[model samples]
Target: MASRTTSWAYRPSLDGLRMLAMYLIILFHTQVPWIQGSFIAVNLFFVLSGYLVTNVVLTEMERTGRLDLGRFYARRVRRLLPAALVAIVGISLVFLLVAPVVRRLGLVGDAQGSLLYVANWRFIAQANDYFAPNVDKSPFLHFWTLSIEEQFYVVFPLLILLLARSSRRGVMVAGLAVVTVASIGAQVYWATADPIHAYYGTDARLYQLSAGALMAVALRTWPVRLPRVGARAVAVGGMALFAVLCFSAVAMSQSNRGFLGTAACLMIVAGLMLDEDQPLAKALSLRPVVYLGQISYSTYLWHWPAILVMGMFLDVGPVTMAALAAVIATGLAAASAELLEQPVRSAKRLNRFRWRVSAVGVACSVLAAVLVVPTVLEREQPPAVASGTGGAAVGKLAAAHSDPLPKDVDWDRVDRDRGTEQTCQVDDLDRCVLHEGSGAHVLLVGDSHARMMTAMFEQLAKKHDFTLSTNIVSGCPWQENLRNTQSSPKRQERCDEARTGWYDTVLPRLDPDLVVVATLPRDHGKWHQRLENRDGSDLGLERSLLRATRDTLDKIEKVADRTLMVQSVATPRSFVPNDCLTSAKDPDDCVVPLTTTNRPSDAYYLAVAADVDAAYTVDLNPAFCPAGPLCSPVVDGMVVWRDNQHLTASFVAHQRAKVWRLIQQTGVLDALDGL
Candidate 1:
């Protein structure tokens, strides 16, 4: 194959690799049931980026005997910035308009994170679960990959220059190998220690980039002369392995990212070295495939938001959403490339001074962060509160007067739920303390269900003048070796690990005035289809809950004078915030009917509370569901449930006085005092 007129030859087959990587990523985002491991396409993109960037740097250095950072930075700016700026600004504006207020709040910070190329760390701090279906997912989540790539781009040039200047080819090779090996080690270690961090962390992903750079260095500094037969075998085998790694997977997991990265490295090395006339290389260089590859950056930028828009607002199925996302993303990317990207990159003035052009990218990013993101959150007057005189019943207040249905503004603040996340979302409960008080020391343990009652407990502790320390983990119970059906299998290994500090050591050490246990007694409110027994028993949900419950009872029986089993409040089947915000004029729209025809009884919890000695139960069912026929989510101008099952801190604060009276009536605290 003849080289192009530019310093480097135009490798259309490399573009084919880009097209395939993006295709897999888009498929993954659409939640294709069979494409669970397609996220590994990001590794391919990382590796490809490393190879191309290193090629550009080395080619310039070899020709001029010195690489110009200014020109390289400028070229990158003109090549990348225009399309990125347009996508971030345009996509954010659309999301602000269509998404609910609660969903839009994070865009302010995320927009800035995207522009500044630190979205990976931002996402890490937020503890985002990339695969979980239940949590609120940001459309900007995909930007984490871009952040990692950009970080490598900024640092790798200087590092590679130093390695090249070392004057020894062996040192350069060793330096690159060290980076690749160390980063892979980080990926393996973090994949086990904390999967979320492992996925998003820059340290864990450097190997993919370094592997590509190494391949580039090998080919650039020291050319490889391979026989045609040998090169053809590598091309065939590498592409085959790449396909298998992406297609042959069970769950959306990070465990196999290293293997995927290795495969990506193989794919690039094989493609780059193989003759263009080879069948695999010829197919990759097809006009349509190469065009798709050219527009892939913009396509990737638009596809995530497109899928999110389709899924959230359109009520479409995942497959249909995926198709629409692909179509819309492709169309937008084509337009962006034609109207926005090509003009800016090919402009004579931008070609002359890349730094000034690059500044425009920074300016556009700042504009998106400050202007576009804020527009998504409409300024709202705070919700009016009416704490009626002298502990008036919320039921009577709502019945006699109009109760304020939750506004979009209200749910936005409450839904963030930092207390719940900080306290219960950890794999370790030792450090997740909610409060430290001066009076009696009360120990709280369970999961998110327990954290929901935090506001009431906060009120209880403040009024009672006691210190409250909690050991809580979301989705997992206090009992060891149990995991819910919801978590990925790899993550399930750490399910009981959350209780490690508290279960065996903290409870025994604290031995507080009282030990309080609160959790969802039934899994998804169904005993038959709940948690699996990790000990490999087919004990299923009921027995799992039984063992978990018994474990809790035994721990509490030994640790405290008395125990209080806090029952979860009556759960509303109707989606909170969504239903309430939709029918804002009618307070009853979000009501949970407690009629025998609609309500489900807490039979298991009641039974468990009745049988255990030295244990008293506090069920806030009456407080929340005061009127037996219908339980209102909004009572006396306060939103009750933040989501379907969890109570808002504001509502809990409003109900705390009543909850205190209920606890006084239970005589559990008083009984402990007598002990």
Candidate 2:
């Protein structure tokens, strides 16, 4: 066989590898069963990119004795930017037409980030959890991979030029090795410390690219010539290993992803080294596979947004969604390839123009996208009316008149009075005192649900003449040494730290007369799905919640004379904010049925509180959802729920008498009076 560097022949097997990687990615995105770990396909692409790009750069350098940076950049811009700009502009237009106002507003930032090729960093800064439930999936999320590749295209060539000037090919190989090691180290560290950031950041993912660069350098400088039988065996075996890893249900984490990256590198190396005549190579060179590979770039670009756009209007099964996504993505990719990509790629005249026209076109489109989307979003906002009275007064006025709804409902500011923005509500476990009374000391402990009640609790604390100290973290349950899997690893670790810090350091320091524990009890499903032990084994939902609830009660009982476990609120099936309700034909349209929601019942809390002596459960569901079958979003014309699960401070203020009575019934006030 002719030397690859000497011949520069198009390798169909490489195209096949690309096709396989693309399919795996599609499968991963589609959430196919037994392919949850197929996100490793991205690692495969990273390696392939490093290899191919490095090979091209090296071949050019070896042939000409110097690199053509201008041509290189123009090639990159022509190949990548046109399709990406099309996707962004196209998606932005669609979002304006079909998406909800809040989602449309968000698209402005997504469009900006994607167009600028910094979306990965944008997601990192936003702390966007890829795996979180009910998260609005960004249509431009797939652009992160493109961003990484584009970034590499910019920096890698410069580095290659510098290395070529300074030393021989061996130095380039060594430099890539160093880069690979450093990047892998960074990946491991960040993956453990902050997995979301690690997953998206270029610093952590650079090693995957470096691995390919190293392979390219090796193949050119010290080409391996294995026996035909050995080459075939290695190629088949490497693919088998890759398949096994990709098909397995292994969790994607820092500890295990290094192995996956290594496996991907091995597969790329084998595919490159094997002859085209080998059975594995021959299968990969098939026409259908090669065509898919040819259109892979545009397919990847369009598939995610296509899925998101389709989902906006259609409620189809996964199979149907996947089919539609494939078809739409393929169609768009073919059009992009034939109409835009191939033409720009072959235009030698445009290359001589140094990508100036392309650059200006991209700049103008991005500027237009940034301006237009936000303008549209701002225009969509409903006009605000100035009202002297608060939501409570407005509620009373609406009740009395029974004519038209009042215009003073500020749904956005519903949680504003909840004191989440207080200086003491830091990310670390710090106590924020919402109310200070001259009587007994009271401490509130739990998660966001606990924080949600602070507004009402502060009012209650003042009414009962007790000081309140709140030690709470959002999304973390008040469970002692218990892991919450639903949250990110960083969050879970922080929760554990906060709990330990409070119990060991803060709790002993602030010995309150009463300790109230509250959390979103409906999160049992999240816990069931996400909670894991230190060893990463599942902590069954019922058992974990039961144990955590009992343990928390026992721990609080030892510190406080009395303990109260506030039952989780009635989580409505849907959240229609007061802003949306203001335009409703009938205000009752905002009412949601209690039976349809998956909130934990009072019985569940009763069972949890049963094991702890003197531990009482306070059910606030009746006050929030007084109507048996239906829970109205508006009670007495004031919005009952600020969002879906949390009560508005104004609504909670109105329910103060009932809540005070419940606290009195628990004898917590009596206990406070004695203290």
Candidate 3:
């Protein structure tokens, strides 16, 4: 029952493993093909942290008869917090000076979260998709992994103390095993619907860390039972398979992440059990490789911010960026470890004053947060919903050709803010805000395309004395038994769930005078975008669109007095309009012809609208796009879109006066008048 009291040995090979994992992280961030899909590198980080911390705690207890938690925390703080805070403070300063406010929109909050070891949960709260293509990724995004490990450090020590009555090795192993199994189960359940949550959550990722914890308890003596051949085979083959997964689409998925975590654990075991003579072990033990591992902690901290900062100045390909970021981060990490990290880590005076070190850690975190206050205080234009009596100001604008880009505009708001309907995802289908104060009710439904219409609806609702609410999501639209093909299989499950939720749960809650369906229609998903019923077969693109539209309308008609469908605006062939206008000498240069290539076919959407009786449709494109070959992004002195497809909420608000006229022209509101 006695736990072994072996001295902790420095394993160069494990450090080598650390180096390799760090490389994978750098490569993934740099958008290396195939590698970007993998989560193995992140799993390996959790395993290493769990294994080493468990070893240190158990070793201390076995040798001293009691765990000194204060000392342990002081050590952890010195090891992690110093370099992390420096990176947070230093990188944030760079962002303040170099990056525009649009790029630095959420950096203040992100830096604070990163400092306090809560960035992981913060991301989960924000519904951040780690894999989503964000043009303005937070510099502190990498800090989420560090936060998870820090959480384990704080909790694991207390857990051991709770189990102090039983010091048996088997008991310790069993305790960790139970947690590992439960963590894996939690991951499976969460991964089914919200993979982003599953990916970043401490509870879901606990098993990966526990894998190493189990290894630490069961194999503390560093003894190898396997022969050279078996060790070589297991180590080489497991790593090879792991590498293959990292390079394949299969490895990119969060649900499949367990396999990668297991593979990492197997590799760690092989590294320990294999003798120094083994090829994997010997190669990993080399001084140069081990040096990278030695500086790996600081390197991980520096990598992402360095990439983003360097990206501002360097116009390079992915490979070049990856190489540049790696070199810069490694160099900086190496120097920081030598000059700053190691000095603080080994300071005998600081180690002696445990309470003081903890105090210093807390103070540093607060200081880092305070550093960004100036930027946060800077006044910027309000996002989404406007700030005045009329709403986001639709001031008289000059001609579209000569009007320069508005300096006062907040690009972050345009890109990020989607009003409060953001909460009413399919997962929470009944979450839409009901404006009970107003006598008449209006509903907006569809995808992000529909979300952009919020401001216009708000305007109409205010003027017409009606209440407006939206049931919209970015990639989800109202469809029966459907999925978004652009979305992953797991996302498809959520999409389908959302469809059922909105129709079966949300629709029946409140009767609305009118329902507006606005979506960018395209042929995608399971069952040809689920055009047919559950029992029916695929009906091609056109027939399928008709069937889907009919199904959606049928549901709306059940509760809504009238239904109004929208034909989405024209898509420009040029780059993101806001970005284009930023550099274009003339605002008109941002305009591009609505070519067949960039323009999506909404023929099915229009046909469905026309065919459905008692269901009116609106085409607001003519108000914005002139009857010509060119599609202007600037309309009525406001930038029409935040990006390629979604209209800016502010722009929509500004155009509300014109939009109301268009709605009046459609006679959809005339029916509202009759009501």
- TM-score to true structure, per model: 0.58, 0.59, 0.58
Q: What residue pairs clash in candidate 2, if any at all?
A: 485-530, 485-531
Worst 10 residues of 1 by lDDT: 382-391
TM-score of 2: 0.59
Q: What are the root-mean-square deviations of the candidates from the true structure over C-alphas?
A: 17.5, 16.4, 17.3
Better of 1 and 2 by TM-score: 2
- Model 3 compared with the native: what TM-score? 0.58
> lDDT per residue, candidate 1, 1-675, as tens digits?
332112356688889988888878888888776775777788888888888898888788878988887778777777776787778778766765554333344456677788778999998877666764323357777889988988888888888788878777677778998999899889889998978789899999888888888877776656555666666666777766666666636443565755665765556455555556677778888999999999999999999988866653353566777788878998999999999889877788666676675676667767777776676543222112211122123334445333565344554676765245333333444455556667677877777777776767866777777877776666766555466767566545455555644455656666577877776645434545656665777754544555666566766777777677665565654445445545556554445544221111133333344435456667676676555435665678666667766767666767777777766656567745422
Q: Candidate 2 on 550-645: residue-level lDDT in tens?
A: 666667777777677777676653444454466776555555555422233333445444324356667676576665345556677666766665
Residue 532, candidate 1: alpha-carbon lDDT = 64
Off by over 4 Å in 2: 1-6, 251-255, 355-358, 365-675
- Poorly placed runs, candidate 3 (over 4 Å): 1-7, 102-105, 221-224, 249-252, 370-675
Candidate number of the best TM-score: 2
lDDT of 3 by residue, 493-536 (tens): 65665576566566776566788777765643343443344435
lDDT of each: 0.67, 0.68, 0.68
